[model samples]
Target: MKVLLILADGMRPDSLTNIPQAQKLIKESAYTLSGETVSPSVTLPCHISLFHSVTPQRHGTTTNTYAPQVRPINGLCEVLKQADKKCAIFYNWEEIRDVSRPNSLAHSCFYAGRRIGYKEAGEALTADAIGYLKKYDTDFTFIYFGYPDWAGHKYGWMTEEYLQAIQSSWDNIEKLMAELGDEYTYIITADHGGHDRTHGSDMPEDMVIPVIIKGKGFDAGKILENVNIMDIAPTVTKILGVTPDEEWEGRALI
Candidate 1:
């Protein structure tokens, strides 16, 4: 089976301590990396860096307003599909509104309804993810959870609301992972870290996010330093016995 990547948008390194479930998860099967994100930590550009394995400036998506373009760079989904493996995305963002893109990425794509804020929108996203859990038979799944980041961006990572939101998201993720069991390797990461409710800057707090991996397939009990967010795509494809595109700037962590 391929890996399952859960991307929590706008999540911070400090927020990791608040979620007991995630903390326990880290203690168990965690191969955590202290990852640095590309500049412009907002959703669209950050996601571009994540998928394309390049800096936001190189990827030409330096802001939320830019339409996603994937030329001169290929993402994990493209690599997986070319290798004859199944890939799917349960996305809740507008950048992927183009139906053709998701269809090309996966055999099936599930775009759940969107919401305004993190908590308000995530309940629907979680349920949508749970439903997709039961239906999809794909080898790889990418689920995006966007509350902690929302709270973090609006209320700061150290605030009570952000902590609570982080915990809640982790609780939901635990349920999903428990149900899936060892059928898939789970990789949880954030696009970027933030502080004082802002990203898109070169600050340490905004650049470093946590990369948590679990499941029997993972090495476990490992810590990586100075990792790059772009590295995840290559690492995931490598685990599935596939080669990443030449344009990708990451190397396999495994």
Candidate 2:
């Protein structure tokens, strides 16, 4: 099965509930608004846990700056590559470039959110991702929208700006679903949430994220339990008909 994994960085669960498109997705998917994120709930660390199916302690990256894993574990992309699945990535943040190791991706597109405003960058990245998906026989694609995180840092979580950013992200999601149709399974989640103007905390606001899965075998409108950020990789591998890496600690949602 083809998979489209969308990550809206620092998108709080509450903000997702406020969006109409997100609510509709929840109604049509197996979702959990209370999915637990790993502690030190920052962007890169949480994303590393998501891709590697391990915690920061295991991955050895507790901060935004990525360091080579002390004992490398196969990330989701690496496993998919081994299985001969074509993968692509579209992201606005440069720091996320390390999510996949060398030559793991069939295509990648990056637009710096800081150079052009985060909102504009997200729009551009989404458009590019749509174009690429239409033209390629890709098995997996990751689309990272950085606007919500940028807005959260600039205007504080739950603020008007942050809510608008969430809305904008939903608009993009709607576009993707409409264009791609139901041929692909869509997994939408956040790397982490935020509190005040910053994150990296144990507070519920920072650790609670939303995981929404729309695809075959998922019960519509079902709210899941015991889901974690680390579960994402195993779930993706399962969808692609590949074995999860032995080092991965999370179970597949399916």
Candidate 3:
């Protein structure tokens, strides 16, 4: 089965209360509101951990800066490509480009969130991603929305503005699902949550993330347990019928 990953950066599970789309997803998917992200809980490091299925200590990217891994490990895209699966990525953030190695991706689309602003970038990227998904037949695709994190940094986490960003991200999610959901299993999550105006602390607000799995294999309306961001890659590889990297520390959920 093809898998599509959608991420809303720095979104807190508690902030989904008022979003109609998000509420519908929570009731219809196998979900965990208290899934944990790797500490540092910063964007780049947590994502590296997610894709590589290991801790930042193992991957060696402790900050937003892309540090070369001393002992590199295959990420999701790399592993998928090795199995002859086509992979694509659509993202607003630039730093996240390093998550997958060169030649691993069959296609990639990026909108500069740093220059045009994350909100605008997310909007444009979502439209383009939807178009691409409708036209293409990629085995694995990842779509990233930077709005929530940018909003969290600008207006405190859980504030109206930040919640609005989360809602906006969900609007895009709903659009994609409405059109192309039955063809792909959708996995939605966050790299990290936030507190006040900043994150990276080990506080629950920063570390706890929400994970929603919606598709044929996952049980609808079921509450999941012991979920972690690193588990994502293992689960994806499992769904795609590919072997996980030997160094991965996470176990597949299904």
Candidate 4:
């Protein structure tokens, strides 16, 4: 099965129900899995953990920089491509553009510079993702939206504006789902959640992330437990019948 991995950076579980479109997706097509973030809870390590199915320590990245390459020695993109599945990415964070990882392997990759509520930038990222999704006809696509997390960092997690930004993202996601139809296994999740909207530290809310799995063949109403961020890659690889590397720490939800 194809994978559409939606990374709504820094999204809290509590925010899902607050957005009508996201809420409908949660109710109709998906189930939420409780998960955690790696230490330092930042974007690079979190995303590396996601693709490699290991902690930041295992993946080798501690900060957002290109050095200290820890995890993702064998990224998900490489695995998927080896299995004859096309892969593509659309992301807003510049830190993830490293050549050592999945971003480099995408059939196409797009990024927007740092800044929250930059409507033109958001539109650019969204348009790129949609374009790649349509153009590649890939079996797997990963779309990472950074505004919610950036908003949370600047405006705090519980603020109305941050929530509103999430709502707008939901609208874009809806467009993606509608266009893609049932051809993919869509997984919507976050690198981490936060209380004061801060991560990169050990905090209960900051470490916890929400996992929503949906699409044509997944089990609806399936509530998975003990799912770590590290498990996501393995789960997706397994479902797609690809062999994940042995260094992965996560398990398939199914």
Writing each residue's lDDT as its tens digit, candidate 3 over 1-254 gives 89999999999999988889988988889999999999899999999999999999999999999899999899999999989999999999998799999999989999999899888888898888888878888999999999999999999999999988998899989988997868788999999999999999999999999999998889988998999999999999999999999999998888
Clash count per candidate: 1, 0, 0, 5
Native-to-model Cα distance after best TM-score fit, residue 193 in candidate 4, in Å: 1.4
Better candidate number, 1 or 3, judged by lDDT: 3
CA RMSD for every model? Answer: 2.6, 0.7, 0.8, 2.3
- Stretches of candidate 3 above 4 Å error? none
Q: Per-residue alpha-carbon lDDT of model 4 for 98-161, expressed as tens digits?
A: 5234333556555564654444456677777777777666777777778888888889996887
* Per-residue error (Å), model 4, residue 135: 3.1
TM-score of 2: 0.99
lDDT against the true structure, per candidate, is 0.72, 0.92, 0.93, 0.75
**Comparison by TM-score, 1 against 3, better one:** 3
Q: Give the range where candidate 4 is weakest over 10 consecutive residues by summed lDDT.
A: 99-108
Arranged by TM-score with the best first, the candidates are: 2, 3, 4, 1
**Model 1 bad stretches (over 4 Å):** 67-71, 96-102, 107-117
Worst lDDT 10-window in candidate 1: 96-105
- Tens-digit lDDT track of model 1 for 56-97: 777787777765565556666767778887876766565643
